[model samples]
Target: MFKAIADPTRRQILGILRGGRRTVGEIADNFEMSRPAVSKHLRLLRSAGLVVTRKDGTASLCDLNAKPLRTIQDWLQDYEAFWSDTLHSLKKHMEEGQ
Candidate 1:
């Protein structure tokens, strides 16, 4: 999941999906890259479980699967708490020194 989202292009594709479901062509239209390149990014996202794609007739519609993102957010919350505590300790130490 981390590897899939590490690329800026993939992140952008995810962002597009956040608005709502979009066809592969609609997604490709947003970028300067070839349709195949966009399809490649979509494939990575699908593998990461970040995207859900379905066939709507001839068009492939992609939607965001945000469940995986909750895991990332939960992991980051630990670091957020750590930083908050560290900053609080630093402030206390600086005040004590003064």
Candidate 2:
């Protein structure tokens, strides 16, 4: 998952899916790159479990699967708590010194 989202293009593709489902062509339209390049990004996102794709007639539609992001959020929350505590301790130490 980390490897997939590490690319800026893949991240942008994920952002586009957040608005709702979009055809592959709709997504490709947002970028200056070729449709194949955009499709490559979508392939990575699909492998990472961040994007789900379906076939509606001839168009391929994509949607965001945000469940994987929750794991990232939980990981960041741990760091957030640690930083908050460290800042609080530093503030207390500075006030005590004064």
Candidate 3:
């Protein structure tokens, strides 16, 4: 999943799909790339379980599954804590210098 979302293109796709479901064509419309290229990105996202698609009459609407986002968030938690500690130390050092 991390590998899939590592690309900037894929990240933008997620952003486009953030509000609600959208057809592959709708997603392709936002990018300069070919529809097949967008489809490939969607395929990777789908394989990662980050996206889910369902038929809406003649179109397929893809929606964010969100659990994969949680996975990414959990992975980022360590970095969040590390930054928090570093910021705290920096604040203390600055206060001491003052």
Candidate 4:
């Protein structure tokens, strides 16, 4: 999952698709690469369960799958709390000195 989102192209594709579903050609238009390459990236995202595709007539509409992202969000919750507390402490000390 992390590997799928690690690529800049993949992230950009995900960002655009997050707004709504898009066909393969429509997604390929946003990138400078060939349709085959974008399709390849979409395949990786699909395999990771990050996105889902459904055939609509001649085009396939791709959409984000939130289940995997929810798992990632749950995993990061603890780290976010830890960082939030640490940042708060540092902010307090810096403010005290000012």
Candidate 5:
């Protein structure tokens, strides 16, 4: 899943989908790339379980599936406090020097 989001284009797509569901055409319009290229990114996102696609009549709507992101977030939580403490220590040291 991380591999899927490693691309700048794919990450941009996720940012757009975060706003709301969008049709393939709507997504393609936001990018300078061709429709097929956008579709390729969508395919990767779907494969990674990052987005879900549904057919509404003739249009395919893509929606963000943020469950995977939550998992990633949970995994990163352990580092948050460590970085916060490190930053605080650096600030204190700088203040002492001043």
Candidate 6:
């Protein structure tokens, strides 16, 4: 899943799908890359379970899964306090230097 989202294009695709379901063409329209490139990103996302695609007649509709994101968020929560403390320490050091 992390590998799938490692690309900026894939991340943007997720953000776009967050608004609602979109057809493959709609997704490709937002990016400067070719439709095939966008399709490749979508394929990776689908493999990672970050997004699901369905056939709507001749068009493929994509929607954000979000469940994998919740898992990723839960894992990141473990480091939240460490980040907070580091930020606080940095702020204090800067203030003293000033």
Write down the worst ten-residue block by lDDT for model 5. Answer: 69-78
Best by the TM-score measure: 1
Q: List where candidate 5 sits over 4 angstroms from the true fold.
A: 86-98
Report residue 34 deviation for candidate 6 (angstroms): 0.8
Backbone clashes in model 6, listed as residue pairs: none
Model 6, 1-98: lDDT tens digits are 88988899999999999899999999999989999999999999999999999998999999999998888888888899889999999999999999
lDDT of 4 by residue, 12-39 (tens): 9889888999999999999889999999
Tens-place lDDT per residue, model 3, 18-90, is 9788999999999999999999999999999988988889988999887878877998999999999999999
C-alpha lDDT values of all predictions: 0.97, 0.94, 0.92, 0.93, 0.95, 0.95
User: Would you give me the overall lDDT of model 2?
Assistant: 0.94
lDDT of 2 by residue, 1-98 (tens): 89988998888888888899999999999999999999989998998899999999999999999999999989999999999999999999999999
Badly placed stretches (over 4 Å) of model 4 are: 87-98
Model 5: per-residue lDDT, tens digit, 2-57?
89888999999999999999999999999999999999999999999999999999
Candidate 4, poorest ten consecutive residues by summed lDDT: 64-73
Checking candidate 1 for backbone clashes, the offending pairs are none
lDDT for position 71 in model 1: 97
Candidate 6, residue 61: Cα displacement in angstroms equals 0.7
In model 2, which range of ten residues has the least summed lDDT?
8-17
Clashes of each: 0, 0, 0, 0, 0, 0
Q: How well does each candidate superpose onto the true structure, as a TM-score?
A: 0.95, 0.91, 0.83, 0.82, 0.82, 0.85
Off by over 4 Å in 3: 90-98
Q: Write the per-residue lDDT of candidate 1 for residues 40-75, one digit (tens) a residue.
A: 999999999999999989999999999999999999
